[model samples]
Target: MRTGFFTHADCSRHEMGGWHPECPERLQAIQDQLIASRIDPFLQHREAPPASLEDIGRVHTQSAIARIRDHIPSPSEHYYSLDGDTFLNPFSWDAALHAAGAAIAATDAVVKGELANAFCAVRPPGHHATPTESMGFCLFNNVAIAARRALDVHGLERVAIVDFDVHHGNGTEAAFVGEDRVLMVSFFQHPFYPYSGTSDIGAHAVNVSVPAYSGGDQVRQLVTQNWLPALHAHRPQMIFVSAGFDAHREDDMGQLGLVEADYAWLTQQIMTIADQYAQGRIVSSLEGGYNLSALGRSVAAHLKVLAGLD
Candidate 1:
């Protein structure tokens, strides 16, 4: 089985504004890089289906779902603000559904042995939206939704969520705070946006917050010391990754100094863990990455590892 790459055209239709960093072009950048690196042909590409509300409901409240469904802007309105950063355009609802759906479908494929692993390239990136609220340029927590599907529907005894985004995946953490079946490990820049991971997250979570300007070596050290041990002990039946590349040194979105090599190394580490304990099952979804050039290159590097091209 090949590495599955899931995405949808609808994802390109959801855009905040011309000025926003989380633009539709983010998806295009990823696609362009995959082609440039000659990795596109090696992937098993699939068009993402829209997620059923039931699938979404596993991780989100009905009211929260209603808020997004109830408030989609008409064509003439152009945009409706959900928060300072999050907005809903006419196509946003469909795009969000597909973004989340890509994660779910990918998870299903990986769990069922139809593919070696999968990567979701849809957006408005998730991981910041909690169960009750959609914030931080997110309408639904895609990774969280995928994790829940692995647990509830697939009946997996242990699953792990690995987040390497520059920002803390507070929403993903919130979804499985006390749930023993799910173990989430992440590293984010300290004193940053949404600023919530510093406190005691939960017994099942290993959140490492690094200071600004931290480099790849520091991150690797922390992962070796912290994330690896927890992941080994968890012995997960499957793995979910909130793959975000904004930590790249070139990305202006955050201050951490990770490069494309760092992302490739990180993916290798996660893949090693997946192979050892999870039958090489992994479903990774795009979470954050703003700088177009860097995001493209970083994703390509990550995919190289996932595809075993590296």
Candidate 2:
């Protein structure tokens, strides 16, 4: 079976600014690389529909949703800031909706046997946005929202979210903190932006925050000593990943110093868990990565694993 690729044209319409790293071109870069590398041939494509208000409300408050909508500017005008680094342009809302919708729909497809697995390649890279705090170039917590929908709406128990974004997914961790049903395992740069996710949160949140320049070996050691044991013990019913490539040595977003091999191995480990416990059910969404070619190559590497072509 083919892995599903979910995205929308509207995702390309939102632009934060002229030189922002989190630009619409990120999506195009992934698509172009996939095409150029013949990686798209291994995946099935689907156009993501706009997410409903209820979908957004799954991980964001009603007031937060209203706040995001209240700031949409006229096409003639352009940009606004939700916070210091997170900016919005004329089409930001619609792009965010589709970015979120891609995850939701991909989750539905995988859980319903419509696809083997799915990858959402939409942007505005969500992982930093908390339920109440819209920061870190993210407006909505896309993977968190999808995981909740899969659990509550689809009646699945024991869902796990594994975030490998170079930066700590403070938002995802915050949303699922102290919740037994959902387990969030994250490895990120410590003392970084937002800088939260250090100690264990109750028992459900497993975070390993190390210093800058910790490379692939460090990631492997930490996962072996920490994540693997916990993951195998939990044996999750479904798996969701916040796949961020900023950890790559080439990307300056963070200083984790990981590469494509690290991503591939980590993905393979998750796939092994999915095969054993979750019936190979997994859903992943792109989170962060600034350098264009690095993002493309790393995404290709990641998706190759998702498709089991590696």
lDDT leader: 1
For model 1, where is the 10-residue window of minimal lDDT?
196-205
Cα lDDT tens digits, model 2, 1-310, are 7899999999989888887889888998999999987899889999998889998888888888877899998877787788878888889999999999999999999999999999999987789888887899998999999999998899988988999988899899878877789988889998898778876567787889889989999899998888888888888988999999999999988887888888999999999988999999999999998888999999999999999788
TM-score of 2: 0.98
Q: Could you tell me the TM-score of candidate 1?
A: 0.99
Top-scoring candidate (TM-score): 1
Alpha-carbon lDDT, every model:
0.94, 0.89
Candidate 1: pairs in clash: none
